[model samples]
Target chain A: MDQKTAGLNIAIFFCRQLDANQDKNRRAIEKELGLRIRFFPLPCSGRIELLHLLRAIEAGADVVYLVACPEGACRYREGNLRAKRRIMFAQKLIEEIGLEGARIEMVNKTAEMPADIGAIAMELLARDAKVSISPVRSNAVASFIEK
Target chain B: MITAERKPMAEIRAMLAPYRKILVVGCGSCVAECASGGEKEVGLLASALRMDAKIEGRTIEVREMTIDRQCVYEFIDQLTGIADRYEIILSLGCGAGVQAVAEVFPKMLVIPALNTTFIGETKEPGLWVENCRACGDCKLGYFAAVCPVTRCAKGLFNGPCGGSKNGVCEVDPDSPCAWQLIIERLENAGRSDLLEAIYPPADWSRQQGKGPKKIVREDQRSEG
Candidate 1:
């Protein structure tokens, strides 16, 4: 990890169906990359709401990532599609407020090996290096790395 | 229902530039159903505005309130005590609701955040089609339920004008010709004979020839 990826606060909202061992993989990625990553597992990606994405930003997440089952693989048919639409809508809302819509991203992955989760995290960190810190990061909360 | 769209962000930001404390009032009735002004929308707008203000290095206090109906006095009265605390009331309601808020609080500065569009029906989710013009006239009996006065480009009393082609309007290919809909509906009902009587031009006096219109329903009024 370079200077930009260091101390970056990443919030990942992923579907439970995407990974069975997320906690172990999350810790492995944090230890390897020196990045502060928080994982929130949901039953399905469709359970994600517009407010969920916004609140993540409000809570000082530099980049919010959503991981869902691949298109037709959603246990609840169309759940992944619904999550895609919501991500787009949320992106539009944040963009309207002069924030970078790319700050929020969605990845579709099947239940892969534990190493794949760490790879995804690395991919996200690489992407985050290109994006600037969130302007709306609240002053009240300390950086996840600092904590 | 009365349909409306949120004003562009640039226009809204301009309207709110002077105010530090703003109350975003949404109408839960017509505007809510149309998805323009509602509780959810109010929250989204408020959040966006706050973030926008923060990004600009400005401190702004934005509050949100959504009443059941903005056009009705009983519902709009709920804002009485809270409205005075804000520097401005940014209403996401339709035009009538905005004016009603201003009228209710004569001293407070009330501004609209939405552009009142038309009286429309939800054709489907996220799609609203204008269906009524409130022309102070009822002509449905003559032209099935499809309203030509509002839907037709020319507002022809007797139509399927030469411009109509392939059952669609010449002005907008996407919109089906209103006359074609009316004729088809009438024919299906075995009322094609009604077309024999040529109707005269519509009387405009009832719609806008007179100044603002009002109806005083003595029966509904409480005794003084």
Candidate 2:
């Protein structure tokens, strides 16, 4: 798949524990993006690791976004802050290794604003398309076609 | 726990280009504890790979799995059958886990998904600070358990280096002088006398170097 398809093939790891009507957020995402997002609920956003974001990229996610509560607004108090820092660290690593750092993202979204989820998803999709595919990936694609 | 960050989407996509099927292996140990990598990452990788590559009849299978510990043979061996199904193994563990996977499955290509840094602790929820060097020696007993090799900006063995200003290292103003911390910890524990014991230069051979190290158990030996 090209960068556009890659952007379309997005995956989100909703670290925050879902609310009583968590399906509403999930349903909105599916309807807007036409992407099946697999949710892995965490006790708190602090539990999500930076390696999870990296491995997701390795496994073939074009855009990996984290959904957390606003800063200091986390029910667990420190969960959102931890998630934000992880996203920052992940971006730094990505930039150092010559990849577009925008592929990994973090945003604060409450259950109240389900439409914001769609906006964030679209933003991520557009952002991922802007990233230039590495020569190694291009070569891999070329070789795969030959086989 | 070791601190690490995620590999970028473009970079990871490039690494897995040659293979159609890929295994995203997560370590539920250190990396998970540090928030550097884990099983939740597997699903993220699978989606990204599917998006970045588009080809006719090209099937990219993304599988997610986690091991209790990827540093040991027992844990690595547990992936026998599941590993064979994937053309490439993307390790979300530290450098040691990636090497262990590569050593066990020489036939398959192994790729690292995280950049492992030094041993650190969660100062708070998101903040991690380097705390140990794993220098293959026990100087901590002599230094009140505050590690100079890992925390000191210069890895100083002697007293606080002259570069220390107001208990902060010159190399990084934000970094605390390890010796200062050590001394305070020692003073509080009433073990200030241990500071008088000079530390000898560490032997490089004892620490990880040159090649792989191994140990044999004679206590558990049985007659053949």
Candidate 3:
């Protein structure tokens, strides 16, 4: 709340099905939170592979969250289930690498709850109030990003 | 199919401590089907190791490669020229795969990243239970398609032990008595006559021991 999460980038990979009006809903959250979010709209939650999550972190996403359709309601039968499995596996990988497993999260929601999605971003990106530029990024790149 | 489980992370880290460069090899056959030493697992493990190295402020390089079947020389041969890039190799294949790679690259150090557990069936996704012993001598015909060598706790062939209480093993109540399964299956098949026929001791020579085993078809051989 005290501008702790001001500079950290939170990447949200949402199933496009989660919000019927993907652009408007995504932009509303982006506008509400301003520059903090970089939304990745996936056709199905199954599209969120472990490599994608790890790559996001390697690219300096301060936090990565997978917002999938509710469990039994995946548009593609069981993409959400597949996404859940990969997310769990990814969490283990992140935990071993020296980051909190909480850095990657998997939560289910329907397409209409833009506020719910925003709430998760606010809660998580805010928890680590100490978001400085990531150690892997140079001050030049960091400052460049800030600009 | 040969089955295995990834070694605990702590043990993997200890073995990996000696190498700055590592190549994690995954098998795409049995281990893949069981969800242990597959392409997905290779990525998960390699990523974990890299992250651990980054956190310690140490440099560790990990590369991942998956072969169609790590036990075959043809597929394993693909790793030949490229494998030397790393100082050590972490094979996610079953025991056979680790040895296959070792046999090919005798000069390279190949380490097993999984504990070769048993030859089993994938009862379900993420669930594996021993179903076959591959005991050269096939006894499934006599046992009504059930394998006594793998199912029986003692590998008993003749009959159920007296310790079977209500069709559960005495050694482990949670385990169903393998003989009970055979007997019930026999009764259903109307082949209880085989139950009365005593099965002599199995030929242990064909099953295990005595160095490496080989099967050669003279027709398939290129030379004498």
Give the higher-TM-score candidate: 1 or 3: 1
Q: Across residues B1-224, which tens digit of lDDT does each residue of candidate 2 receive?
A: 77777776667867777888888888888888877676665555554455344322255777888888888878888889899898889998899999999999999899999889878889987688888777777678777888887888777777898888898888899988889988889899998887777778887676787776656699886688
List iRMS (one decimal) for every candidate: 2.5, 8.5, 4.1
**Sort by DockQ, top down from the best:** 1, 3, 2
lDDT of 3 by residue, B1-224 (tens): 88898887878888889899999999999999888899988987886776566556567788999999999999999898899999999999999999999999998899999998889987877789988877888989899988989888899999998999899999889889999999999999999999899889999888786887778898888864
Candidate 2 docks at the CAPRI level of: incorrect
- Please state the Cα-based DockQ of model 2 relative to the true two-chain complex: 0.09
Best by DockQ: 1
Instruction: Tell me the TM-score of model 1.
Output: 0.89
Can you rank all candidates by TM-score, best first?
1, 3, 2
- Weakest 10 consecutive residues of candidate 3 chain B by summed lDDT: B49-58
Model 1 shows how many backbone clashes? 0
Q: Is candidate 2 or candidate 3 better by lDDT?
A: 3
TM-scores for every candidate against the unseen true structure: 0.89, 0.64, 0.84
Higher-DockQ candidate among 1 and 3? 1
